[model samples]
Target: MSNINPFDKCPVYETINLIFTKVKEEDAIDLFECYSDPITKSRMNNDNCGGVWDTHNIDAVTKGIKGWVQEYNDRFYIRWSINHKQINKIVGTIEIAPVPNTTRFWDGACQTGILRIDIISSLENKIVLSEILRMVSDNFYVDLDIKNIIIKATKDDGERVLALENNSFDKLENSTFPYSDYYIK
Candidate 1:
């Protein structure tokens, strides 16, 4: 299943005024910084993980991005770093992965989108989140694609969930993967 090709050209997500680019080694510090906030990290990693503050694992983060890039190059996975142009910082990440074509019954299960966008917990940033979602939805397009998208967030991530819904995401009840959707799961 590692043969899909993402568009070589960078896609412009105007609402957020950022370009979706492959996650790179250089992104380690920015990502760590964004994930450093206890609230932000907990919200994204279910509070069970997220030691980015004290345990600033730059090597691990860089290696993770390298692996992601390698997987993208092989078409096994796709990961993008969300650059917040307004602040000139890397705000968060998004990804898509092809279901492995293995003997598992769910082989060819479907492509899935995984997104984790960081935003200030203010009312104004809620609008920013919505705009970001709009840009993401409009700019994302590729083959082996799935009709549904998923997102993952903790219970405290209500604002993000709301923003995603406002932009066209439906939550799946009794689901258990960060958030219930094809894009963020």
Candidate 2:
């Protein structure tokens, strides 16, 4: 298990246009808007493997926030709500955690961190997204004390793939699991 609760020091990063703050229960509307968008939902693949989530109701998002709180109890996951400070809205979310518990018996056990990102549809938000990617990459790449960091990228996410590549995250193949077809850091 992890020695320190990473959430305790959850850093609040700010850019000229955004604020990355610890997500709390008060962010229901902002989170709901983020998770309910069709494009965001489709890209996240939260329904299957990724810890990302898609919700039809604000209550579901509230529950998801609680889930993050419980994940802290398990000492495994923490999510940050990406708030646009000027607009007073949560435009997206970012989650970082130890990879979920599985693939140990056959896949080999090792310490790893997974970063999950989700944002509402904004055709002009590329710069904001890029900055967030770099910020998190810098924090997690060597600072997290984990051997590896994994990012789940869909085949069509060119911008995201490019950001990961810019941060020195190559196509990680078979560190512990067979990710020959997956991009990781």
Candidate 3:
């Protein structure tokens, strides 16, 4: 495998209906729609991350996007804006980062990617999630040099749970995380 860092030049992932690319300042308006929506925030997995997805204004959204870019530069994580093809707008963001030792969630020999996906509640269905999950499953392992992918989905999130299951993600029954149930692929 190549030793180059994927964060050096964020790779864009595309599906038939959506595109995932590094979050940019220009995405503030569209992202604000998602960030400010209570429904979207309800489905987001903040977990150990200190930041909250809910925002009150575009300024906060803009600042958040800048922080995400800086985080990418620091190799802390890669946050991608999920753009819908038909709508021609950013529907949400997907954050993929290495499982930190602080979490103590995975004891596996190979590294694992912790995925946090937050999309507009209207599009937060099995079909849309399955497509996004498929893209992650197909590329994130080799791109991030990880053997597994893990995500959090609450029991109430029936669509997300079903999508994860359809994409070959099994629930981690003994997960120590209290925020929600975790699934591994």
Candidate 4:
């Protein structure tokens, strides 16, 4: 089989108010701001750190994005920077990968296109979130042949939970499952 990596090529998505582009080493500070936001931190599971997802330290954040570069090269998963088109700043990130084969789905088997949107406190709303999700689905899903995508919502994030539901995500009854909801198209 050929050995080309999925992330070897760059991807960019332009929406009405935002853009999704490749994450880079220079995005360390902006990434830190997104990951460190209290609402962002409180809205998702972050038990695993030691990467760009680490909110407390800039060095850790830098190390994290740098490592994501490596991870991209390795073709394990991919993260894209979410930038405000008008302001020209990264407000969040989205990590996409295959469901790790350990998690259960509606059919009770792991699936591809498991996703996580890590955004700053402010952008966690219906309008922006809907646009981001639409961008990903409309742009990348077919190229990747994604069967399903999932987003985990924190216990206290009622707005996000509602958004997920509105977008047709089925809530996995067992909260202990790594992600709280799943989306199939």
The number of the candidate with the highest TM-score is: 3
Per residue, candidate 2 scores C-alpha lDDT tens digits across 45-159 of 3422556555879999999889887776565566888887778788888877665455221123535766778888672144666787777766654445566667777557777
lDDT of 4 by residue, 1-185 (tens): 11333455656779899988879888888988887787787665543333335458888888878877777776666788888988889898887765654432222343556677888888889778888877877755554545667666665677777777677776666544453344443
Candidate 1 residues 70-136, lDDT tens each?
Answer: 7766555556787767778777766654423221111346555445465433322557677767766
Give the clashing pairs for model 2. none
Q: If both were scored by TM-score, which would come out higher, candidate 1 or candidate 2?
A: 2
Better of 1 and 4 by lDDT: 4
Q: What are the models' TM-scores?
A: 0.69, 0.79, 0.91, 0.80
Global fold similarity of model 1 (TM-score):
0.69
Off by over 4 Å in 4: 1-5, 47-53, 101-110, 173-185
Best by lDDT: 3
Error of 4 at 132 (Å): 0.8
Q: Which has the higher lDDT value, candidate number 1 or candidate number 3? A: 3
How many clashes show up per model?
12, 0, 0, 1
Worst 10 residues of 3 by lDDT: 101-110
Off by over 4 Å in 1: 1-4, 7-16, 45-55, 99-112, 118-124, 141-144, 174-185
Give the lDDT of residue 161 in candidate 2.
72
lDDT (C-alpha, whole model) for all candidates: 0.56, 0.68, 0.84, 0.69
